[model samples]
Target chain A: MAKYSKFAAVGLLLAFPLLVSSDYYRHIMILALMWVVIGSSWNLLAGYTGQISFGHAIFFGVGAYSAGLCTTKLGISAWWGMLIGGPMAMLFGFVLGAICFRLRGTYFNLATLALAEILRLVAKSWVSLTEGMMGILTIQTFRSKVPYYYLAFGIAALCVFAIWAIIRSKWGYYFVAIREDQDAAEHLGISAFRYKSISLLVSSFFTGVAGAFYMNYMGFIDPDVVFSLYYISIMAILVAIIGGAGMIWGPPVGAFIMVLLQELFRSAFFGYLPKWISEAHAMAFGILVIVVIRFMANGVVGDWVKLSGLFTRQKAPIPSVTSGN
Target chain B: MEMFIQMLVAGILIGGIYALIGLGMTLIMGVMRIINLAHGQLMMVAMYITYVLYFYLGIDPYFALLVAMPALFLLGVAIQKYFLNPLLKIDSIIPQNQILMTVGVGIVLTETIRFIFRSDYKSVKTSYSSATFMIGNISWNVPMFVAFGLAVALTAGLFIFLLKTDAGKSVRATAQNKDAAMIMGINADWITQLTYGLGAAMAAAGGTLLLPIYYLFPDVGSQFTLKAFIITVLGGMGSTVGAIVGGIVLGIAETLGATYISMDLKDAFGMVIFVVVLVFMPGGLKELTKV
Candidate 1:
């Protein structure tokens, strides 16, 4: 029954664009799908590997700029960004890992954050190369939201599947072992550093691809939007945490909910409510973060039994299997 | 040579205020063992309080400091007692829950201020705001000098408190080892709240001092938040003395970067230093000074 529900959920997502003719809803779905890729990647590193990065925006922005540069500097179809962006992001990730992997826990988090900020400053100031804050404007290939939605869906699906596969493999065990205890993992002959870097590399690649897709779909790229600490990096963390950080399906679930919640607030409950509520959308995100962290740190999916148990007095049936599996 | 000295003086003046901000963050970091990402937002709240008192109530910004500091102290105690303290009991996979909570608090604070004040940049103008004194070739702004003096006095006062007072000793004990402090009959929970309050009060003082020279806006808190953390890391995580030196180094580097390099990349200099220090000297200046 659970398996059937999972299939039904995927089917609903695939058919969502066809069901929703409104470009606005489709646009929201597309953005949600992009976040799925980014969030899942982050989940791989921080949730699975225990390397909490506050700098996912570094990969994201680097991937975006690579794509943007392909058009302006290299004079190729931005579609080549789809090919090059991931690898470019991976290369930078390797270097970042080399420098930052030495630090553990909060230090690693801050290092990544500082690196992302530095990248933003670089992108903003390197006007001749990045066109500075003027931003990059490219003609999006397709005018309809349908193509973008499908593309985002395909990429998100691919990313989710890839992460699911990685977690099921030996690498996934190593990642989890490291998360559980880095010292123990090392004692067990797992090179914690190598596995952590591998996790980061895979995580960064998908995030970069998502950033590239964002550039193509949005038809714009800027330092502020692409490399934002609050919007991109923190948003990635929020999505992963809100959905269920360690769970395979958590990020995608989180992405959809967050995107929908944001859209609902941004559109002032689909224009049913007053306009001023839309301006408070960011505040809503902040509040959601606090409430979620406070009450649902394991996330809705991770704490499904506990959360459902709250509404009903009846004891929730104890599942034979844990969600961690 | 003249340009160098002028920049040095400017850096030192700004560094004094930076030290105050760093001191607050380091205090929180020491006790809680979590970076208070909301440190600058707290300062921003205090600055707004000062701005309101000045703009509407006809109080001088300097006089507003007394009101803002205590208000912020109470606000900090409430946050620590209510928001952060509650999270310690919740079981979660992530060890950084408190840090993430601080981020949420910062965003909420910034957005709330934005909702109330809008995003318009506001500044207080005092007679001393533009006043400057000349020492040979270097010019020192009068307000900057006064702010610097106040920062030094506060630092001295803090050192006295931390070194001499029982409450201060308990706070230090809690920071050093929570369990040991608890065993020593210190109310670790109360000490945590007190430390957070003291940290917020210090940040409030820093914000009030910066009012005359700096502009105010809801988003301005984030810049200072980053600056505060950079100073904390540079000063060696929880070391008060280290924060002081780190602040000065960051100030000098920033001033030099603005003068010699592009002014736009001045902020980047601190980040660059942060990364370098993290990689090469993780213990920061505190590790070197061994104080």
Candidate 2:
């Protein structure tokens, strides 16, 4: 009964906002949903598999470019563009995984960053396809934010459900085991490479679709925005760390909190601040993640669940608790 | 032939700076096994410090180094002691947590720098900052030469420090095997802190040294940081010697490749080296650590 009430409350909150939405609030919602998908996808790899990629923007760029290119150049439907983009991103993800998986520690991170930068450079220089740094203009932006809001929400829901399914399956267990101890998992007959790559593929698919979503909504696509390692990788890490990455609800919760915080700060500062402050604000967001992770360790959501268990008289069960230090 | 030689010389000069950047990273990674995304930010901060001394106080870039190094070294020590030491408590620190911790420090550092010192590009101006010497058909910039020379000097100093001092032995012992060294009455904490400070100081040195030639901005850290990382991997994760040599090779290869290969694919060429190295030999010029 309590669980049902909890669900009902959440449903009401979600439903109540949709009934009446200002353009500003609606814009915020569209962004929040978009991030939910991207952040969840990032958490899938960094949170679960323990790969710690700083190069996810490459996959996002691939999807955006592929989708954008298809629509503009070939005059293809976004439906077909998305269909092609997902596989294209997956293919790239598989190759990236296979290549960089051998590198232990920071080498992987550095290599991933380099690859993302390479993709950004490709998107910028290859004017014929990506339309250069000026980027793809005149993209299809809709009148009502409802379709975008729902599409983003649906994709995010799908990602959460997909990750949840994985958690229930052997694959998720393998990821957890390997994340804890790679050698031990290998000893236990789990192919670390295979599972890692599979998780990456799953992560990339959503990221690509999110990229497609981004191009459609923003009405402008640039190498900087699409290939922006700044947006995809750093923001994903922030969401994952803050929300207690590696758990089903981690990224979404983190994304909501972070996006909300940014909005609050940006609005609060208003015209009083300079553009540098705004850029610095993004950096501040990243710093907040680091500070929280440094101190909180298990991250915000992870800690919440842990703390809740301690206070409850009956060891109030909150599932796995995003188990961490 | 003239263009090729000029690029080669230029690459070698830039390679020296890359080596300097990689050396500090290798030193920390060898001991700590954590990636400091803040490495570049620290360097940027150091450069800004150097810039202030030079631009505001009218200190020479070389004298600014004296100020930058010690300041960064202390900042490095404090960060490691307060922030990183705690994070390194567990056996193997969580990869993502390390990312957050380092990048957290990085973002804060980068943002604070950008906040304090606007996004405008600041370069150290010496009469010699841009003065270039000509040799037959080849020209060499004084700032580049000084930076390159300093890179060599710093590497030598680091080698001597690691080899000569009692603390150096502790550092080496800890780097090789943390548990074994811990058993040997070596204070891993002290060694780790000192090593980090040393590494951070080296970055400050690089920052100040490269300030004349390279542009200083809050975001400039990302560029050198990424390049330093590539050099670190190419040379060897933990090998100091490997980093220097790898820096030169990478410098020359990419420099030459940019002209010979399509400039559009210049970055891809560097990435090609990374991918090739990872696939064929994950260690590149350096041997893999057995740990």
Candidate 3:
């Protein structure tokens, strides 16, 4: 029955574009698909590998920039970005991992954050290559949202499948072992550094591809949009955590929820609410993050049993202190 | 040579305020073992408080320091008591929940300030803001000089408090080892809250000092947050003395970069130094000082 439901879900997603005619909804779905790729990749590195990076935007921006550079500098079709962006991001990931993996915990996190900030600064100052804050604009290859929707769906599906495969493989166990106890894993003869680098490489590749796709679909690229700490990096973490980190289906679920909720707030409850509500959308996003972290740290998928139990069990029994006494 | 000296002087003066900010962060880092990503946002909140007092009440920015510091202290305590402390008990997949919580706190603080004040750049233009005094071949901005003097005084006061006071000793004890401190009848929880408050107050002092010379905006906190961490890393994490030296070094480096290199890359200089320090001298200036 579960397998059938999975198939049904995929079938629905495949037919979504045909069933939905509104370009706005389609656009939101496309963005959601893009986030699925990013969030899942982030989950692999952070949730599975135990390396919480605050700098996924580095890969995403690199991929987008690579694609953007292709059009501006190489005078090639942006479609070639689809081919080149992943490897380029992976190469950067290797360098970043080499530099940052030596540090543990908060130090590692800070190092990645520094790298992202450095990249953003470089992209901004290197106007000769990146065009600075003016941003890079290119003509979209296709006018209709339908083609982009399918492309995005294909990529998201491919990413999900690839992650699912990896998680089920021996490498998946190795990743989990490292996350659970890095020192113990190393003592057991697993090279923590090697597995971590592998996880980061795979994670960076998918994020890069998603970024390249974003450049193709959006037809505009800028350092701030791609490398933004809040919008891209934090948003990726939020999507994974909000849906459920460390769970196979978590990030995909989170991607849809985040994108839809953002749309709902951005549109001010679909224009039924006051226009000023739209201005507070970012605040709402911030509040959502706080709420999720505080109340649902394990996320909806990870804590499904607990959440359902809360609803079903109207009165939670208090433990009697008299027994211990 | 004259220009270089002038830049050095300016850097050292600004570095005094930077030290105050770094000291706060290092204190929090020492106790909590987590980098308070919201450190700058707390400073931002204090700056807004100072701005409000200066704008509406005609209070001097210097006088607003008292008001802002205590207000931030309370704010910091509340954040620790309510938002951060509760997470310690909850089991989560992400081990870095506290750090992430700080990030969320930062976003909320920035957005809330944006909601209330809007994003237009605001600054307090005191008569002394642009006032300068020339000595030899170099000149010193009057406000910056006053701020540096106050900063040094505050640092000295903090040292005395830490060394001589019972409460401050408890904080130090807790930071050294929570279990041992608790065994010695210290309320580790209370110490943590107090430490967070003290850290925020120090950051507030830094922000208030900067207000006379710097522009105030909701987003300004993030840049300062980055600077604070760079100083923390440069000084060696959790080392107060190291933070002071790190702050001065960063300030000089930035000033020199702005003067000799492109102004656009001024921020990058700190990052370059940070990476170099991380790779070569992970222990930071604290290792060299052995203090």
Candidate 4:
């Protein structure tokens, strides 16, 4: 039954484009799928490896710029970004890990954040290379949303599958061990730093791919859009946290919920509600983050049993507090 | 040489204000062992409060500090007591949930202010907003100089409170060791809340001081929040003395960077220095002074 449910879910996703003809819903799904990849990558590093990064935007923007630069500099199809973006992101990840992994806890988080800010500034100021704030624009291939949707779906699946394989492997144990207690893991002969770097490499690779995909899908790239600290970095954290950090299905579930909620609020319930509610979308996300962290720290997938328990009461009756006698 | 002196003077004056912001962050970090990402948003809230007082009632931004500081203290206390304090019990995978929560709170704060004031840049145009004074070859903005004096006085007051008072000692005790502080009858929870409140008040004071010279907007908090953390890290996490030194150093570095380097990359210099400090001088100035 469990296997059937999993297959059923996959089948539903595979057939989603065929089932839904509207571009609006399809666009939202593509975004949700992209987030799934990004969120899962973040979860691999922060959730599993215990090195919480406050700057996934650095990798994201790098992936995006790699794709954008391919078109302008190389004059090749932006589709080529899919091939190089992940590797480029991984290269950045290696350097970032070398610098940040030496530090622990808050220091690591801060370094990543500072680096992301630096990248944003560089992307903004380096006019000769990046065209500065003018941003890189490209003509997207394939007008239909189906191709993009399938591409997003494939990447998300590949990301999730790769992460699942890694987690089940011996390296997964090392990652978990490092997360639980780096010192204890070291005592057992596991090199914490090496495993952490591996985790980051795979994580950033998938995130970079997502970034490249975004460039292709959106057909435009800007430092503010891609490298935004609040929108990209923080949003990734929110997706992972809201869905359940350590669980495999967490980010996928989180991505869908977050993307849907954002669209719902952004459109003000498909324009049925007042326009003022549209402005409150960011605030809605803020409130959602607070509520989720406060109440559902384990997220939707991690706390499935608890969530289900709320709806389906137990058959066992409670004993009377006072004795009948 | 003249430009250098002018930049130094400007940096030092701004650094004094920055120190107040950093002091609050350092205090919260010391007590909670968590980075309060909302520190700048709290300051922004205070700035808005001051703006309201100044624009509507004709209250001076300096005098409005009295209202802004107390109000922010309450807001900070409420946040710590209600929102943050509860998280201590909720078992979760991420130990950084509190920090994440602060990010959320910061967003809500910024968006709420945005909803109320809109995104238009607002500034308190006091008579002294553009006034300047000359001391030999170097000139200092009048509002900035006055702000620097007030900031110094506030720092002195905070130092006295920290060094001389019972509550202040309890805060230090809690920061050092929560369990030990509890055993020593220090009510660690109350101290945590008090420290947060005090931190918020300090940030509020900084925002109020900066109002006359600096522009105000809803998103202004995030910029200062970054600046505050940079100062905190530069000062050697959780060290008040370190925060002061870090603030001044950062101010000077930023001023010089803006003057000499591309103005567009002014913010990058502080971040670069922050990363360098994290890598090489992890203990910040605190390690040098051994404070």
Please write out the lDDT profile of model 1 over residues A1-325, one tens digit for every residue: 8789999999998899889899988898899999999999999999899898999999999899999999999999888898899999999899999999999988898999999999999999999999999999999999899989989989999999999999999999999999999999999999998999999999999999998998899989999999999889999998988898988888888998888998899899999999999999999888887888898898877878887788886676755644354
lDDT of 1 at B177: 95
Which residue pairs in candidate 4 have backbone atoms (N, alpha carbon, C) closer than 3 angstroms, thus clashing? none
lDDT by residue for model 4 over A213-325, one digit each (tens)?
99999999999889999889988988998898987889999999899998999999999999999999999989988999999898888777777777896442432332100
Per-residue lDDT of model 2, residues B1-291, tens digit only: 899999999999988987888788888888988767788888999999998888788999888889999999999899889888887663322454665577777777888887788789878778887899999999998889988998898899889888998888889999999999999999999888998898888889888888887787789887677666777778767788888887888788888988897777675666667667767878768664332
RMSD of each: 1.4, 3.2, 3.5, 4.2
Model 1 chain B scores worst on lDDT over the 10 consecutive residues at B90-99
* lDDT to native, each model: 0.93, 0.79, 0.92, 0.92
Question: Which candidate, 2 or 3, would have the higher lDDT against the true structure?
Answer: 3
* Residue runs of model 2 more than 4 Å from their true location after superposition: A13-17, A269-279, A305-325, B90-93, B262-268, B288-291
Each model's iRMS: 0.7, 3.0, 1.0, 0.8
Q: Pick the TM-score winner.
A: 1
- Which candidate order results from sorting by TM-score in descending order? 1, 4, 3, 2
Q: Please, what are the lDDT tens digits per residue for candidate 4 over residues B26-122?
A: 9999999889999999999999999999999999999999999999999999999988999999988888899988999999999999999999999
lDDT of 3 by residue, B1-291 (tens): 999999999999999999999999999998999999998999999999999999999999999999999999999999899988999988788888888888889988999999999999999999899999989868899999999999999999999988899998998888889899999999888888999999999999999999999999999999888899999999999889999999999999999999999899888889888887887888889899986
DockQ of 1: 0.80
Q: Lowest lDDT 10-mer window, candidate 4 chain A?
A: A316-325
Error of 3 at A106 (Å): 0.3
What's the distance in Å from true for residue B83, model 4? 1.1
